[model samples]
Target: MVNLKLKLSEKANYLAFLIVFVSLGLASQSILAEEVHEPAEQIAPHQEQFEAGKFVIEHVSDAFEWHILTYKQHHISIPLPIILYSNNSGLNIFWSSKFEHGHASYHNFRIEEEGEHAGKIVELNEAGAVVGLPIDLSITKTVAGIFISVFILIFIFLKVAKSATSSTGRAPTGIQNLLEPIILFIRDEVALPTLGKDKSERFLPYLLTLFFFILIENLVGLIPIFPFGANVTGNIGVTMVLALFTFVITTFSGNKHYWKEIYNPDVPWWLKYPLPLMPIVELTGVFTKPFVLMVRLFANMMAGHMIVTVFVSLIFIFGQIGGPALGGAVSPVSIAFSVFILLLDVLVSFIQAYVFTLLSALYFGMATSDHH
Candidate 1:
């Protein structure tokens, strides 16, 4: 009995040891993953102070720096850095000695040597040149992403449309086969449900375009590579443009009933007689609706990315404080949460795209509806 008890005790100790060993192994991997992808800004303060195991979250969150030119005009420039692993340093435009990893610089432009450096911009001899002037004209990561997304969507849609026309009204094939169902879902589940059939078709093209554009941009932002990771939809400028397009369409298509509800609402006799400033309030709401759409999408997407970055940064911050063990222990939880957020982001990308499309369609329906 004593010998049997001894053997069981030994087995329990071995099992405990095995569990500890496995847990440590997983924790080590989690730490490695966290360090390998550290943001550029988090790794180094000025691209000159990078460190190992701190590659992913080193770059500036927004990267916007204003430069005041000799001409006294304010210009804005933002750098989009390329992410690379230590082994892939060769791909970087410039290697960081501190980081031991290479990084490719984005928004590379020369400031005229003559200008005062107001932050990031330098004044040019001719006109104050923002280091990166005419943003839309440049070959930025966002621009590249936009072009790629546009091309893919256009190509796929055109092919599908052609196939539908050519095949005696049969269903599409290949890429079209993949896209047709999504299109139908948008039309049936999203468009018709919100805008009704007759009104929905008119706005279908724009809604479809917006949906794919936002979806592709959101996905591309996650890649963390050159000519990628531009947070296109998170940029307020991009969101504003999209919202403006929807607003214009909605306003232009508004029927008499829609305008009547806004300009001359059927309120109580006293409310209408006193000329209660209802018209002004209603008029303002027309613009506010699109503005809300822009802010909501931009804020939500950007916030998620920022939160992931902050959590990842904690590992490095803790490591520097002689708490490597604690940092190591915390790493698994942090990485798991980051991965969870990333997965959530994927769902959000699709949901935002759908929501934007559905709301736009609803507005169109309201605009074109026969009754108020």
Candidate 2:
């Protein structure tokens, strides 16, 4: 019965993962096929527009401010610190609001409204044409989100640790109780199985950290308000860094046998001779493994966020085109779909964290495995 229960649990997890992936990917088709309508030749200077594509993209993209809501053309957002350095401006430190929600320029540096540099800080020449770029070390929305998520992870784990240490023999309680199963799951099911008992303990700490960090960030991004919804895990840059860490650890952990398998495996001489085809393929696999890790997490998390935003945007799009009545009619349906996706995203958050950690553990095991 215990074994049967475990099998069922594993099957359920996979089923949920497939559901989230397929549903989110299919729902995002509308967003991928969205048409960007160009502006008229002569348009009003202060004209308002509701571009669904921009709406969805802006929500997923990083920003200098934490936008709460926009009411009556008054943007309500928490401005993050803007730390910039440039040849012309030297070092300018100020609030992102000094740019006034990208409406004004500060110190001749402004967030580009359009063109190739859209959504980026650019330095302007005397003629107002873009001339240079600044080294931006600002605490943007995504950066802030990362900081928040890291803080939450540290706080929760520290408390859990303290609780476990204080009562050595007693049953786990509170946060420790909540998280103990997950920790054990990583150990018994993921690490121990893939990496074996010898090295699993050695790498368990990193695997736990990786799993929780990605999991927390993924869940936090689903929160649609204040300090939480920065889309940190959805960002390709963040995923790339996470994947690079796994790659670095795997490469350094590789023993002589691992490299030997890559360079000159126990295969046909023809495969490794002349053009060194097998070696080339094996070398390519080294790079592609991490690349796949990066793209998979980024694409999956990004699709979830984008699909939810697209559903919510539908209400506004209908409202604009057919006024309040049409929008009011669509609001319930749109929100229902958004809520459904948000729930799926929660499941995906766990699945992605598990998948990344599992793959990483497998790589580490292969790298450190002894030639028996």
Candidate 3:
């Protein structure tokens, strides 16, 4: 009986680990959030309705102003700097607050509410038509998040490095102690096997940096607060840049053997000569490899955030349609599922980091392989 009970307990613990994760927003998003609202009376009837989709999109998307929270139907946000340059305006430097939550214009500039340039700062003519766009080099919310994460990464490793060097023979302690195994895991299980001793030693630094950078960004994005959550990995631009780095590294690392495989791969003569299909496929793969890395990370992180927001939106959906009593009744169930997803997402964050690093190492291995 005791053995059976322990088995059941083990299963329960495993099941518990499978619980929730919210995509981009997680718990930080409010279903009924008053998102930079203009006055209700002036708004259109359809516009007054609750839009979970809009909220989710806004939650995951970058913004000129960092929205902290909403209270008493007021949006509390920190407006960022707006650096705009146009041939006409010369250089218009101002704060995002001047736009007044997309309600007003400042100087000769306005935040377009609809059409092509919606949510963008467009330069207006004297007669109030949008004539052109300024070169906006503002430090957006995502940019700020990247800066913060970079700072944290630097701070963490510097301390870990100090602790490691100072305690040479002694056992690791504190943060160094905690991260040692993880560091070794990447070096041993990931880099060493794929790249071998000589190459692994040389490339381990890049691999380690890649692993921790993605892992930290993924985890921090789930926090849902300032300097914590910026949806860094979910942003395609960020992922694309990261993938490009891997591509550039692999390209440069390629040996004579690697290039030979691409242009003059060993295959049946008919297959190569008929239409050059084999060579085309081989070359295409070189570009596709990094594309896969970029899309996979971006899609996984982006989907997770959006799905959770959808799950949480259920509560407000029911509340709006059936009144508060019914909404209250449904809250627990919706929240339970959201929590379940959020928990599962935590596991995914680590897996994605490991996978990205592992694949990168594998690519590096293939690029510099000594094999025929």
Q: After best superposition, candidate 1 residue 368: deviation in angstroms? A: 1.4
Q: Name the lDDT value of residue 248 in candidate 1.
A: 90
Using TM-score as the measure, name the better of candidate 2 and candidate 3.
Answer: 2
Which candidate should be chosen as best, given TM-score against the real structure?
2
Top model number, lDDT: 2
lDDT for 77 (candidate 2): 75
> Candidate 1: where is the Cα deviation over 4 Å?
1-122, 125-137, 158-174, 323-327
In model 1, the Cα lDDT at residue 318 comes to: 70
Order of the predicted models by TM-score, top scorer first: 2, 3, 1
Q: What would the per-residue lDDT of candidate 1 be over residues 1-372, giving only the tens digit for each residue?
A: 222222322332333333323322211110001112334454544424325333333231323211111121211222322222222122222112222222222323232323353212221223433433221222233443454555555555555555655664454567657765676677678877778766665666666666766777777776555445666777776788778878998998898999998889887667656675787788898998899889988888887777677668777667666567977987888899888888898999888888887888877887787872
lDDT of 2 by residue, 23-72 (tens): 22311110011112223443346747789999999999989887888655
TM-scores, all candidates, are 0.65, 0.86, 0.85
Off by over 4 Å in 3: 1-47
Q: Taking the candidates one at a time, how many backbone clashes does each contain? A: 15, 0, 12
Clashing pairs in 2: none
